[model samples]
Target: RSPSLNLSFLYFCQLMATRGRGRGRVGRGGRAGRGGRGGDQQPDPLNQQQPPIFQQPPPHQHPPVFQQPPPNQGQNHVQIMGQFRVLSPPTFTGADGPQAVDDWFMNLERIFEVLNYSDQEKIVCSRFQMIGDAGRWWSDVWRLKTTAERDAMTWEQMKLLISERYYPYHFREQMERQFYALQQGNLSVEEYEREFTRLSHFAPHMVDTDFKKSRRFLNGLQKDLRFVLSSHGYLTYAETILRAQQIAASQRLELDAAQQTVAQPRMIQPVSVQPPSFQPVQVQPAVYQQSSAQPSGSGGKRNFEGKKKKNQQNKKGGNGGRGDRQPAQQTPRARPP
Candidate 1:
C-alpha cells in the first residue's frame, strides 16, 4: 500500500475510537457555555489546511427585557399645594419651660428631616446656622469654641445640657402637653396617624398600654371618623387604625364620586303641571276704554243725572231762547299734573 493511503486509514480508525467522549466535551464547559453541549456534535480537526473563519453568534431567540417598578405613593406624598419651604431651625432660648424646649427640639428635628439628614451630631452642629433672635440664642448655647469645649461637644451632651437648663420636667411636661393636644385637624387618617405616632413618642406613660393609647387616639379623631370607628368595635390601637384607614379609604371614594357629580353639569328637572282644581291665576290686562258722552263710573252717573234734571227744569221754564243758557256743562275738570 501507498504511504498516504496508510496514513488516511490510520486517521479514520483513531477518530472512530475517540469520537464519543471528545464529542460530549467539545465547544462547552459546564454551566459556563453558550447554547450548551448536545448529542448532535460536529467534528473539529486537530490541524486544518487553512485558518478558520469566526462566525458571528446568532441573535437572541428571546431578548432579555427590563420592567420598571411602579411608584408607591401613600399619604406622605400629597399633591403639591404651595412651594416647598426650607424652614429655619429654632435655637435654645434662655430659662424657658419644657414647652419651649419641646418646640425648639421638635423644630430642629423637623429641619433635619426636611433636609434628609441622618447624623445627630451634624444636626446639633447645625444650630450655628440660625439667624436673628435664634442667632443670639445659639451664641448663648455655644460660646467661644476652645479646644477643650470642642472635645466635650457631642449630640447627647448638647441635648442633656439644654434639657437640664431649659426644661426640668421635660418628660412630664411633654407627656401632658402632647396628651392634651393631639387633635386630627385637616389631615386624613393615614396622615393624622403618622403625626399621632410622632407625638405619642413624647408621651410613653400616657400610651404605655395599647388600650389606653387606642382610646386617646379615638378621642382625638374628627367627628365623622370618630363616630364610624366607634361603631366598628376594634380593641387594639393597630386594629382601630386599620379599621379607620378602611373607613377613610371608602370615604375618599365617596368624596371623589360626589365631587365628580358636582363638577359635571346636570339636566334641569321639569316643573310639574298644576291640577285643574288649583288653576293658574288669571291676570286682567288693563283696558284703555274710550270715555262716553256720559261715562259709566260713579262720577259719570252723577253727571248724567244732573244733566237730565237740568233739562227737565229747562222744559218747565218752557221753550227758552238760546241766550237763556243754563251754566256750562258741570263736567269734572282734571287737575294738571
Candidate 2:
C-alpha cells in the first residue's frame, strides 16, 4: 500500500470501533443512546414538548373556591341621620323599666332634620326640645346656643333626657307601639283612622290638631314605630286584626240569615163552598085533616076534600100522578109538577 491508502484505512478502523462500542452499550442497557461521556442522553422530543407544571394552573384553583360575606355583618352597625344607631335594643318586657327618651335619640336625630337643625348650636338646642327634658331641655338649648358644651353620652342617656322632658309612660308606650306597626306595611287611610281612634282615647291633645298635621305626625310616627317594633319582635297586631275580621264575617253571615227569616211571610188558602141538598117536609095528620075538611067547599072549591083524599090515598097506597117515574126519584122530589 501507498501512504494515502494507509491513512484511509486507519480512519475507517477508528469509525468502526466507535460504532461498535455505541451498539454494545445500547444492547446491554436496553436503550438507544450514545456512549459518549457527560450524558450524551438527549431529551426525548415528546417529554421536552410538554408544558411545565408551574406554567399551568392546579385543579384546585377553581371558580367555586371564591369566598363571600355574611348578610348581617354590616347590618348591626347602621347610622340614622348623623347619629350612630347601635344594634337595636333587645325586646321590652313588662319586667324592664320604661325605655328612656334617649333610647329614641336616633329617631330624634331624624326629627331634627325636619326641624331644620343644621348648625351645632341649632342641633343641641333641638335635641333638648326633642327629648322634652323640661328644665334640662331649656338649659341644654341655652348652653348649646350661648356656650359650648360637650357631653359624652351613651344612647341610654339620650333616651333618659327625652323621657325626662316630654312623654309619660303611657305616651312612650304608645309611640313605641305605633312605630312597630308602621314597619310591617304601608298604612292605609283606614289604618290611620283606626290609629286616630285609638289615640283619641289616650292622647286627645293630638286629636285636636288639624287633620292634615295630625296625618303628617301619624305618618311619621308610624314609620318610626314600625321600624323599632319589627326589630324588637313585638309587632303581631296584624294577626289579631285578621282574627277579628274572621269573627265579624261569621257574625255578619248569621245576622243576614236572621233578617231574611224575619222579612218573608207564609200564606194560607180559603176552603171551597158546597150547596145544601133539598128534602121534602112532611105535614102533621091534624094539620092535614083540618085543611082537607075545610077545603071541601069553604074557599070556592068544588069537591076539594074528595079530590085531595084521592090524591093522598093514591100517593100512600099506590102510584100518584107520575108514579111511573117514582123509581128514578128514590126520595120525595123538591121540584113542583
Q: Give the candidate number with the greatest TM-score.
A: 1
Residue-level lDDT of model 2, residues 1-337, one tens digit each, is 9876687677567655644444323444565456543345434333345443335567779667567766562342222323422322222112223443334444555655564443443334434333223444445544664222333443445444445544467765676466434422455434654764544444445445455333433344345443333354322335333433444456569989999999978766876778877898997777454554444446637566667877776676655553334566368669986
Write one digit per residue (lDDT tens) for candidate 1, span 227-282: 98888786699988888888888989999999999999888899999876876889
Residue runs of model 2 more than 4 Å from their true location after superposition: 1-125, 128-149, 154-156, 169-237, 265-337
Error of 2 at 237 (Å): 5.7
Give the Å error, residue 36, model 1.
Answer: 86
Prediction RMSDs, each to the true structure: 27.0, 28.4
Number of backbone collisions per candidate: 0, 15
Clashing pairs in 1: none
Tell me, by lDDT, which candidate is best.
1
Q: What is the overall TM-score of model 1 with all chains considered together?
A: 0.34
Report the error of model 1 at residue 144, Å.
Answer: 10
